[model samples]
Target: MDIHHLITKLREKGHKITPQRLAICELVLSSKDHPTADQIYKKLKQKFPTISLATVYQTLHLLKDLGLLLELGFPDCSARFDPNISPHIHIICLKCGKIEDYETENLKEQWAKIVKDIGVEPIIQRLDLYIYCDKCKKNQ
Candidate 1:
């Protein structure tokens, strides 16, 4: 996503476009991995020495509330942020803690069928799968 798009979104939502918030959004957008707040803070701190972890958390939560990001939670792990807000699946490596996003037409079809059969409009949905990564499997 373009930085300009995010800036426009903040403007539309009547949010102040602070430099720190912009940096957080840019980091999330550019990151390939779903990053936790600490990871984001660590990266941003290198450039923004005064950035606080609390500020990062607040910004992330605000972005999520605005429907611009997805927050992923795992047992025994800090919640991670995803810039792709659309529905998708997450595959997590149980050993190395690696996470990747997956998509399939079958899942979408099944989701539609389930929602239709239940006769209830859904607000949100998520699917997560955990497995050992290739390197972990090889080691095992």
Candidate 2:
């Protein structure tokens, strides 16, 4: 979602639109590179020096709760946020901590079919493939 639409949604939900909140929204949504909460805090700190990391975490959680984004979290890893909430696999670079989305629209359709065939409902859906991304592979 674009910043305007996200901000409007927040407003409709009675959320206060502070400059900091706006910055966070724009930063997260506009980012193609999935960013961890710490990464966001550091980038934002460059401009909003007083902004707390807790605030970034809270905003990220709020976005996730509202289905505006998806969180890619793993044991012993900082959670990375992806605004492209469509069905896809996250290719994580183990060495550099980079994340790239691998679109799987057809996979979603096939998955739905399989679920229906089995007569089961899914409670959660996420796909992540951890690997040394090309650059990391080259380094290795």
Candidate 3:
């Protein structure tokens, strides 16, 4: 995502664009792997010595509330943030903690059906599949 576009959107939402928030946005935009709040804080701390963990959490929540991020939740792990806001499937490796994003027409249809059955419009829909990665399966 373009930094300028993000700034413009934030401004349009009545949010003040601060350096810390901008840095967080950049990190999320550039990240290929979904990162947890602690991971984001650690990366930001290298350049911003005084950046607090609380600030990172708050910024993440703010971004999520603004529909700029997707929060991935797992039963046994911390929630990770994804910058890709589009409808997609998350294939997660249960053993190695690897997460991969994929898109399938079949799943999209199924999701649509489920949503229709529920009779409510959702802001976002999440679909996750958990399995061991190839390496982990081979190791076992």
What is the C-alpha RMSD, rounded to one decimal, of candidate 1? 1.7
Model number with the top lDDT: 3
Once superposed on the true structure, which residue ranges of model 3 sit more than 4 Å away at CA? Answer: 105-110, 113-118
Candidate 3 residue pairs that clash: none
Ranking by lDDT: 3, 1, 2
Higher-lDDT candidate of 1 and 3: 3
Q: Model 2, poorest ten-residue lDDT window?
A: 120-129
**Model 1, range 49-103, lDDT digits (tens) per residue?**
9999999998898888877788887778679898877667889998988989898
User: Where does candidate 1 stray beyond 4 Å?
Assistant: none
Error of 3 at 95 (Å): 1.5
The better-scoring model by TM-score among 1 and 2 is 1
Candidate 1 has which clashing residue pairs, if any? none
The segments of candidate 2 whose C-alpha lies over 4 angstroms from its true place after superposition are 120-123
Q: Could you tell me every candidate's TM-score relative to the true structure?
A: 0.88, 0.87, 0.85
Tens-digit lDDT string for candidate 2 (1-140): 67788888988988888898789888998898998888899999989999999999888888888888888777876678888876677787778988887786698888778879999876556877889878888888
Residue-pair clashes per candidate, as listed? 0, 0, 0
lDDT of 2: 0.84
